[model samples]
Target: MFKKKVVSLALVITILLLSIIGCTSPQAQKQEENVLEQEWKEVIASAKGTEVNFYMWGGSRTINQWVKGYVAKNLKEKYDITLNMVPMDATDFVNKLLGEKQIGKKEGTIDLLWINGENFKTAMDNELLFGPFADNLPNYNRYMNTDSKQITTDFGFPTKGYEAPYSKAQFIFIYDQNKIEKAPYSFEELIAWVKSHPGKFTYPALPDFTGSAFVRHVIYEITGGYEQYYNLEDEAEIRKKIRPALEFLADLEPYLWREGETYPSTIAQLDNMFADGEVLMSMGYDPSKATSEIVKGTYPDSARTFVLESGTISNTNFLAIPFNSPNKAGALVVANFLESFEAQLSKYNPENWGALPVFSYDKLNDQEKEELADLDLGIATLSQEVLDKHSVPELPADLVPIIEDEWNKIVGK
Candidate 1:
């Protein structure tokens, strides 16, 4: 009789617990949690000892060295993963992926690549990228500010978790402090200065990265503002709206270097011309580029960087996994490692890459915050406060190629 009563009481307790919780028992819930933990472990286990092929633009020596040195070393130590960084233009890689997709290739040579703006849009549109996988990164969960516009959007298009924000860049004009007492503060001031100083100023010709950025800034200041262009996708309509900015460029052309007959073909050439004293100012998308050049002894100590009072445009670059990557597991681990606090800190140092980190300052713990605060961003880099104060969003991606093509016809011709 006592055993029967004890068994009946246990059955009643089980029924009550299940009724309260609507069906899941405590043991069942625990098992589900264990399965989730196992899944994460499986991902890590699969990534170990694999080689990840990372494709990126091979334009900067400092960037190349940092990747081949610091990044490669840490990944090998932590995950036993071999990183092979392939240097190539982002467009070429995107096109490569498109070719793979068209042929229904199940595997591709690229594990990951760097891109932003239109290139990223093209990849997403063509379904050439892997996953909404950014949320899967451990470091991304802990350190990233996903709520921020800088992370969620690239050039007015939603990222939708397709890529992880890598670094931040803003446009700034570098000038010889010894030559110009004050950098131009507005389009009007810049034009006046250009007219007075003949053959002393010229941007890199269109189709160049930094050169296109300079044109975007001109559009922002002259044709109202950036927000207006986000929804305006019509090509002809955009041309009409930007006519004034073009006229402004045309009016200043004759005073440009080489009498506006030609322009520097690249931002590097423009920087070289400035260093050689052929032009008074050089401009680029990187705020710390002047600092990097000075450190290399290519630019004089007199070099300084400044942005327009109307604010310079800023954009975020990202890393994405290719759709057909044979090593998706390796790519995930590598990307997670890159977003770690250690990698971000190294990339921030001028001795390394000197690019702005994508992590929010508030997300950092006290020690991490102190480390970031201690980095000497070099003499030519602007204070974060100033850069933030004058920072503007980039124009929509679709509008960029239009600006480039039209500039070729009007300003370049």
Candidate 2:
């Protein structure tokens, strides 16, 4: 009787141990929540009472209000940190940081910033950005590691965990569906459209993101392949190969733009022109811009998005902290919140904001996805599959200027 009781007790102990192990296993818990809690506490402890000043493009009133609301509500409630959104254009942010460096301001006024592509690359090259701290972030795993193109790379600048990607956008061709239901399906067709409808299509002036992206749009098409375009960063090779593209643009220029003498100052200007009936179409980095703008009373209700048959470049923008930031922990909290599923969903709702969510769809639940489906989504719903099928040209920093200068010379603007 004693031996039977001892054996029974041992069996129960073994079962309990197995149950505990199984419960904590990767397949069982569905998340590594333990690590997150530990890291969150550590981050909070390190950044207890600091305020982070976030600088970003503040052109849109709706986006500014959205930022204000998110910062005021969540950061205070959860982290007891204050976030101040410093509205500065991208160029100004870079210029300020460069000036600080020149004057030896080790700790500058700028704490956190939103940047990507050329701006992010310039900051990284100049060593104006802060830590290799992204991997240490508590919610880092919620994102695909820095290896994912959207997370790891910026304008061919490898992030090296320096920046956290917040959202995705793409340079898409825009047109009126009512006047022209059959959008141009090829670059050749686009050229044909310009010839068919002279003075109807135009991109913003040089140095503008939309216009620069339009230059890249042409580069990706004439290069014959996406991989080749990404790989050919050599200055001489780029100039030589891109000549055909420049020629194409130069030829298309006379027919475009009013008198082909002056161009709209910015994509926003181009959008305004389109709204005023000066142009039939405008360019946008955000494929959903038509819907988002129309909802906000910026663009006409009839506007829509389209893609050339060869496709356009899709890129992700990111948030980063300066090395001299006074509120490192607060910045982390803000960046993490921006990447959270809740924030992303709110951003993707066309009626709400319509910014593209960078989070992979596989990571989201059925309920979350259903919300996306139920959204009064924009008319220009480019399926993720179709978007993934498109090309994303990662040009070398040097070549950006070459294309822009040529664009200027072509338009004489």
Candidate 3:
């Protein structure tokens, strides 16, 4: 009886000690996690009635409408949160974050950020983001395939929960089927098509994201594959490894539109060239862009998109919180909401935004799977099955500048 009393006293003391140091029993932690106690519930409570400033590229009218209309309305009605979207270029907002970081400002205007690829790398490198928070989000924990490579990395850099994926995007070459019956299925075939049809094919110049991606695809084909460069950090080595791609580009220049003297400065210009029949093909990172353009009447009904047989590059755009956000809790709430099934579904619909959802088919409930199946991806868009089978990962963010700069040198020479 006395030994049992001593054991009980010892247990009580250990529990008291754990509580004092903010530690808890494993069972207690599990119980707390099951209910989303202080960790998430408190965040939601703190977030209510606060305004979250969302800074993003507002280039698309439809994206802006979805944000200001659907997203904002839902937040207001359900969460009692006000979402303020600030329309700005990615570069401009990144600069704003840099400025704030330099001044050591503890509270800033930006609560959430929309960025991906090199920009995400820059933000993370500068410590301008507020996370590891994505893993803590309720929707992220429930519906996200946290283990998937697509969500774990951004442009080959480990995300580590600094951001949550907003949507899936893949590179596709767009062509008018009425003009060309068959789309090229490989870089060699594409090169042959370009040579056969002189002055009918051209990509936007270097430094343009789409043009840079096109160049990267060429490098991937010429340099063997993308796996070797995963750990390759040296710029000079990358330059040497990709020299063949540079030469290949230079050699192909003579067959390009305008005899390789110049290229379109922007993707919009390339699309215009395609529309006017000056160019036979255009390309975009957005998988559904071809369909959206077709819907806009910019391309004929026969216009369509396709990936190369060897696959094309793909990436995830992400939402992040600024490090010094005035409303960190609210930002977290909003970011969580963006990753919710309803928001992802709305964003996937063609009439809405047409961006692809990030959730895996297996991760979604049967109802969610049904909803996703019911929605059409539109005629001009490539089927999701084809896209998944042929998807390639993006080059690491650090390597992009080397490739882009080298291509510029090749162009200049």
Best by TM-score: 3
Error of 3 at 101 (Å): 4.3
TM-score of 1: 0.79
Question: For candidate 3, lDDT tens digit of each residue in 77-155?
Answer: 9899999999998889988889877855555678899988788888888998877778788888887778766788998
User: Higher-lDDT candidate among 1 and 3?
Assistant: 3
Question: Least accurate stretch of 10 residues (summed lDDT) in model 3?
Answer: 27-36
Off by over 4 Å in 2: 1-38, 48-50, 89-110, 192-208, 229-234, 251-279, 292-301, 350-352, 380-391, 408-413
Q: What shift in Å separates residue 110 of candidate 3 from its native position after superposition?
A: 3.4
Backbone clashes in each candidate structure, one number apiece? 0, 1, 0
Q: Is candidate 1 or candidate 2 better by lDDT?
A: 1
TM per candidate: 0.79, 0.75, 0.81
| Predicted structure with the largest lDDT when compared to the true one | 3
Candidate 1 least-lDDT 10 residues: 27-36
| TM-score-sorted candidate list, best first | 3, 1, 2
Candidate 2, lDDT over the whole model: 0.72
- Each prediction's Cα lDDT score? 0.84, 0.72, 0.85
Model 2 agreement with the true structure over 1-413: per-residue lDDT tens digits: 99999999999987875553323334212212222344677767645565778899999887887788865577777777777889998878998888776655555577689998788877887888877767766456674444566577787668888898777887777777777768887888888888888888888777997888887777777666545655765667766777787777776777887746677879888888888878888878777777767777876667778777666877788889875565566677788878877787777766556677777665557886676567666666665546645646456555688878766655444
- Measured with C-alpha atoms, the lDDT of residue 302 in candidate 2 is 73
List of clashing residue pairs for candidate 3: none
